[model samples]
Target chain A: MIKARVTVTLKNGVLDPQGKAIENSLGSLGFKGVGSVRQGKVFDVSLDVKDEATAKHDIESMCEKLLANTVIEDYQVEIV
Target chain B: MIKARVTVTLKNGVLDPQGKAIENSLGSLGFKGVGSVRQGKVFDVSLDVKDEATAKHDIESMCEKLLANTVIEDYQVEIV
Candidate 1:
């Protein structure tokens, strides 16, 4: 079995309201010197595949098909 | 300027409905050999603090206070 981690993040130019909310909340809670709180998603998947190459390929395909919204979010797949 | 990444994941044995939904969706989408689709949150934060120790400390505090639910989720903080 192979393990892979997929991280999906918003595009640089996209506005992240959730992140903005967190930043404001942090400030209200007295955490200073903090800025640019961008939120993203992580997926830890266990694969029954054999090789690293196949695992990466399948995971990338999964991101493209279902895991990530390619229009505004970018995804990175790493085999661990 | 310092940069940090905080990853929050459900603790073992915690119920993760969103993850289960994704797992089932993956199977429905024709991705085979996939199991244990655990989902999580990632926060990319930029800090105006100096030094790694202070940054790490502050980030950890953020996790404890806001980013994670201490009862059910575990968070990892890294200065990157």
Candidate 2:
């Protein structure tokens, strides 16, 4: 079995309201050094896959098809 | 300048409602292989530090002070 990690984040031109909200909250909590927050999603997946190539293919398909919204989000995957 | 990565995830005991929502959404999108989804946060920070020790201290302070909710989350950091 292999462990796969996937990260999804908003595209550069997109606005992230959730990230802004967190930034505001952090400032209110006395975190004065914080400048901004860009929230993203992380996933840890366990797969019964054999090699890195096949796993990458399957994971990329997963990200493109369902895990991320290609219009406003970008994704990266790491297998270990 | 150095780059630091901070990842925060739900404590093992806590329930992750957002993760469940994403899982359901993926299933609806026809991703048959997806079994579960656990959501986490990642922060990429650029710092003007010279060494790893100070960076580690400052980053850990950031995590404890603002980046993560210690009551419900655990965090890990990587300096690059």
**What DockQ, on C-alphas, does every prediction get?**
0.92, 0.40
Model 2 chain A: weakest 10-residue lDDT segment is A29-38
Give interface RMSD, per candidate: 0.6, 3.0
True contacts kept of 1: 0.92
Best by TM-score: 1
What is the per-residue lDDT of model 2 for residues B20-78, given as tens digits with 9 covering 90 to 100?
A: 88778766766555556678988766555667787778779878988889999999989
Measured against the true structure, the TM-scores of the candidates, in listed sequence, are 0.98, 0.76
Judging by DockQ against the true structure, name the best candidate: 1
lDDT of 2 by residue, A1-80 (tens): 66788988888869988868766776676544555567787887655566778778877887888778999999999985
lDDT at residue A49 of model 1 (Cα atoms): 89
* lDDT tens digits, residue span A1-80, model 1: 99999999999999999999999999999999997799999999999988999999999999999999999999999887
TM-score of chain B of each: 0.97, 0.93
